[model samples]
Target: MRMNPTFIVMMKCSEEAGVQNPVFQRLYICLGALKKGWKEGCRRILGLDGCFIKGFHTGQLLTAIGVDPNNQMYLVAYALVESECKDTWC
Candidate 1:
């Protein structure tokens, strides 16, 4: 955030039984450069999608994409969430 004032990074945590500290629940990120580029040169249309991760750390990968002038897919933002549901989407 210090490097880029427009950069955004948010994290959510929850308390669990027998845990001294809060457990990480979700994470969202948006790069300043990508956001600026999308707003300046990319189309207004946006595509949102998600996929499940299959490794040890299972979670959902959500992404927001945009179309550039050349009709190429441009990544705008993304988030790592526990699951794909109404709560996470918001």
Candidate 2:
């Protein structure tokens, strides 16, 4: 048996104003390896939704979940935004 190397595919974050606020207005997650795997095993259709977060910062979680052949849900991509406005969706 053989094992592949471990590494970080994607990692990113955006801050609000100067370092003072340090709050992230938006956050995204998309793993390069997962994307490639999805293309090979997942369906073409993707389900998306947004929900409010009750934490201190208070925001919306936008996500795209992939529906596999077995009707299972797999995370494809996601984002945390300050709001769920039209501009943000676009």
Model 1, runs deviating above 4 Å: none
Which 10 consecutive residues of model 1 have the lowest summed lDDT? 81-90
Q: After aligning candidate 1 to the native by TM-score, how far in Å is the CA of 13 from where it should be?
A: 1.8
Please provide, for model 2 over 1-90, each residue's C-alpha lDDT reduced to its tens digit, 9 standing for 90 to 100.
Answer: 124333223323456566654544677676656666677889988889899999667988888888777989978888877788775654
Whole-model Cα lDDT per candidate?
0.93, 0.71
Estimate the TM-score for candidate 1.
Answer: 0.89
TM-score per prediction, in order, is: 0.89, 0.70
Residue range 1-90, candidate 1, lDDT tens digits: 688999999898998899899978799999999999999999999999999998888999999999999999999999999998888766
What's the number of clashes in each of the models? 0, 0
